[model samples]
Target: MSASMDIRTKSLSKPVNVAQYLFTRLYQIGIRSVHGLPGDYNLVALDYLPECNLKWVGSVNELNASYAADGYARVKGISALITTFGVGELSAINGIAGAYSEMVPVVHIVGCPSTISQRNGMLLHHTLGNGDFNVFADMSASVSCAVAKLNDPAEVAAQIDHTLRECYIKSRPVYIMLPSDVVEDQVEGARLDTEIDLSIVENEPEREDYVVDLILKTLHSSKKAVVLADACAIRHRAVPELTAFLDKTNLPVFVTPMGKSAVDETKENYGGVYAGDASHPDVKALVEGADVVLAVGGLKSDFNTAGFSYKTSQLNTIDLHSDHCVVRYSEYPGVKMGGVLRKVTERLDMSKLSVQKIAHVGPQAVAEKLEGADQIIDQKWFWPRVSDFLKENDIVVTETGTANFGIWDTKFPKGVTGLNQVLWGSIGWAVGACQGAALGAKDAGSDRRTILFEGDGSFQLTAQEVSTMMRHDLNIILFVLCNDGYTIERFIHGEEAEYNDVVEWKYKELVTVFGGSEQRTKKYRVNNKGELDALLNDQDFNDRKGMRFVEVVMDRMDAPNSLRLTAEASAKNNARRE
Candidate 1:
């Protein structure tokens, strides 16, 4: 027998290639899809994406892709999209700008021509000036940060890491430029780092003792101190702490349109959605008559704050936000709202208050109101029925107008719901987000039901997403508020006639058109309250099997709650002038 000797040689650690390392790092950070259009310059990076389990999402256009990525990021926490050189990058600027304005973390990846090609002027797809690639660099100032070229392949590793980290820290968009040759070159020393932590900083700002004192004193002074949570507050997830404080003080809470679900709308202290709309006369009166208003997570956007009412001098307001900054009446530079709020109960006394005051108001009361309304017979009435069909864990996305307003009255037992408040406030967000949310829910290992309530106008905007839904055989329900007009626009511009209306379609027919066979789907249309009730009673549509579409015919003039307020305000303004 011959003895075998084992020989050991040290493994040489070559420099990691830039393209493979960065792509792998992105996958580690939960970037499942790289949205972009392919160009010759950036094809090298695109080729390496699939190796890291990253799929390329081709968009209709660069701008739309950016918006889609923004939407995806809004739902998934981090968003990234790639494009080739100047034209593609420039085309995507608007969506990126919108993301920046909304404080969404979207990383913009642009693939540039190689250093040699740029020097040689090879008529690249999007090359502009040879001496200066400053267009994107200039635009970066408006966003959070921007970088061009990995330059030295050695610096590629740290630069990519720093840029992404800062993007998450600032909670805004960042631009990264990748040179073609660098991605294609064999990396000799690069390394794939551990997952990037994209979590936003949760630090509360410094407190303003004076502001806190004023707020607490005012709360003690008034019989009712209304806490009006705006859109920003709700988006920041301040609900639990804010609700606890309000309950501790036995204070009433009301939210605007953007703040619709800030707290369970069915709670006793919940004054209802307060930005005018069709809320009860008593609820509206409560908001109008509140002694002191605590505006948390607010934005002075035209729609929510009464078209920019409560200016610095007009109202005594204390604003709180996730940014940790507080601005009182828009005059005071403000204290940190989040920080001051956290410490509020510590300094204040709340034991005197009755904890039982915070009972969950039943959905029956809302149902009664829906049943009693006579003027506008619309899908707004069907929401309670739909709400009943939904489990506590269902995720709901509403389109614009009556559909949105109807769902606004819905009280979720437990679950998440969202609508697009920015980027054109386009109608089809429900369908689009339905796809996104369904994908997200599936990935999160939850069996939560995903529901989309779409208005006629908004449903048509990105109805194509439904095709994607059918393609994946996702189990989702589509409830179409088929009033057949841009009802929200009609209310906003006060244009009850002309271009506001839309050509109606058989909403349920879309399923068949999109390849959902009879066995795989069910469809229904409810023209009256009786039919709606009957449809709600049917158990065939309850289970998550394939897909379903229920179209509820509503009156076009069934005005939303916000429009009602706008009209009354307009009437009052005209009367005052007269």
Candidate 2:
């Protein structure tokens, strides 16, 4: 039925309040828990959550709440973030921007003053004192893909549907301003019967066919065609199709840093990570030497590409993006990669190609330790050794510091999903993300263990979030690398600089302070490789139950080879006057 018809049938079905309608939409889209804090403006709206079958996840602060929502969205496809008018929304902006940059879908709902007060221009406590109610929404509009001012009862549900649709389809953040008065505004309940369609718009059949034919023809002519998958392929949910393409062609698959663990490293054909100059010698040679590069969902930012040092030409690379596809210099707008990949995989004639090659340089093959393992924890020993502890179907959250760069050295078991702010480079984000992602994994009904590798300096910024995890009794494994300061920043510019240092905190004690007891949560401080190995080998510790925290003390200056190369390149790039 049409929207007009639904409105007419309101008497047949009991009308739902605006908050009820909004919360129902969120619940419908698999947001089991809503993340954010409550305020005077949003307090009334919280009452309707239980009735809508949605759990409220009140965080330590809006910033952490936003970060949690981003993480939740990453695991659960989309998440909802609730905040109050000005201060609350502003605090959450950084996290929202991170989600926007990384293509995580999060609906940011800002509960504002009543519509009457806005028209009267009354100065509110959270306001700028200028009586501009629209200012916060305007500020968030820059980072959000869609903005909805939900005041009118007639348009509220439709506005929410449209905004949420954009959030899911575009895989980015969207803003919804829900006024206090509108919290109880009546809307036709019949609208809830029909679910909102969130299907991506299909590419023009003829154009898609042409693109697929072109890609296959190019592949047929090339002897060395390699699949270079990146962030967008995962973000746009094209992994299944991309996997099929890889399998059909039997081409070697290499992932970018953002696309780490995208392809199963356990696969025989899985090539090592390829990030410009930072790539492994064998992987680098194979990728750069390839006649054709099938670049899928690529977001080649400076850090991701080792300061944009990629030698692969656009002419040699066929970039398959979320919205479009580019073959050499030709751009096909509205031609999505999912359908194109699916078609290409179906029509691909692998028989025409010479020796459908597999990767000889697989990361699955662990080399014997060249250095002694008796020494204290260092980047080289730590990252590779930790890989043995990881299980398949785990959700690993790496902080945007040394942890992010170091994790590249660790090959994940199959189905291990990785979460790191590669493009945004936001520190202190992992703690909150780990919490939400744990909840997201639980909601997904997948028995995926959630593990967090956080740098001490980065963990300090959002330390309070651990309390939220304790309160929820989430099953999590946390690793804090205590290197005394900002290791990533130190390598980038300020090594030994006082400004780069952060005060050392007892990580194990913090978990206790956050309400975790020895009986309930396990906390360990491992200073060396032997201690780490013993802890990992403990059968009780590997149970994947309760909150387990480990603090790893390491040399402040030591970093992964990928980080060292990328940081030096980044430093040189920054220093360039040209």
Candidate 3:
């Protein structure tokens, strides 16, 4: 026998059940829990969760479960979600699509019928009344980077490892379909000892040296240089490297909306968020007026770039991506961003860099007291007050709509992290995401508080997740903005349309309705600015134990200035031309 074949044969060890093999591999990684819903098809596989030393987080629905998993993955580096075929998997597809768009590493496992049933074309309960079992798998391929359907035991281990490796390497979602009978099929357990290759592609030595030298030369020669960091830095786990580069070169740094919290906001060189026309005047001047811009992991989506209003020329910008580096018009493939940054930082002569002293504007100061006796909670007063309430080591999650756009105005403190769905713009994502983020923080041994700023309309969509938080005893302080209806939708197209209105629910009664303990779960309703101010000042409320829910009542027409501007731009874009 050949040497390669002999080595492969010798690696096989004693046989173990397929479920054990799969869950053990997941456990070997950093995943301590699995977020999912139970169905008849996946019930047996669910049984293996506890056996493999993994906690099973039963979410209220598949979509919420997937969202929670996405949130967990963002903090824990990787997470998994298990759902049944057809209906269950399809329901979770939207969340999976969001994960893919945001570059979150999530493993989506679906339980399927037995291979015999699929071969014989037996009618399935979750199917579309058709015998075609491949339909859902095909649909999943659109959103996932890799797909694996385990039909045979001999190939199941290899398939699982391959799909998982792809999920980790690409930092995107991957789909794995496990037939009901195949869950118990025996597979060689020795393969578990062979670590899956999660390494990124290495750059060509000569090409990497040339690109780094060119970037250094351009930066050294530039009179005005700036650094723009975006969401990809966080997605690709390059925060440490980016931080090192920033520490070495004290260039002015500005982050995109999607890249908030990627850098330490307290740093003196950190300017602020840059969103083209929507950016602060100082930030706009530095980013738009720079002679040479080094953009690291920058994503220029329409919303992020303020409808493509960025005026910087590509010829003056050097874009560093996860797998490639673009120096002006020249592209160098396989040049990893983290490595290139490290090299550039090591080789660059700091004495020759830009010495222009740009004054850094700190967060806007909040008004100490409102002027009127009958003070109402409005966007102008609410955001700044909330910004003062935020402290270090807090994970802030904002729901899409007003909260998402409004949060951009709030300056995050040092060690604080911000989470939002900008590209997907999915409503009700933060509620479910809070549950997972809180749990992930606990699992990672961090005492960081998970604070969710949710919308009333968005909260109503996935309100059932509050019970899950109560069940897990997670420490999450939820602030629900009760604006009476869909405020963002009203700004987008329908100002006073009846379709935009949502049924008002008693927000304070949610804990009781969700079967939470009265002593452990605290609920409060704030109607005016004075009431909210008292709550913010109360140390007892801020230092409370267990889950605390607060509903802040506001005018239906009120919204942040940023959202109003973006909505106007969107409306103009949607208008029909003559």
List the global CA lDDT of all models: 0.64, 0.89, 0.87
Model 2 misplaced stretches (Cα beyond 4 Å): 1-13, 355-373
Error of 2 at 217 (Å): 0.7
- Provide the TM-score for each candidate, comma-separated: 0.79, 0.97, 0.96
User: TM-score winner among the candidates?
Assistant: 2
Per-residue lDDT of model 1, residues 303-336, tens digit only: 5544444323225456676654444444334344
Local error of candidate 2 at 446, Å?
3.0
Q: Which of 1 and 3 is the better model by TM-score?
A: 3
Q: Whose TM-score is higher: candidate 1's or candidate 2's? A: 2
Question: What local lDDT score does residue 578 receive in model 1, on the 0 to 100 scale?
Answer: 33
Tell me the tens digit of each residue's lDDT in model 3 across 374-445.
577898778878878888989999998888878777778888888988888789889988888888887888
Task: Kindly give the stretch of ten consecutive residues in candidate 3 with the minimal lDDT sum.
Answer: 1-10
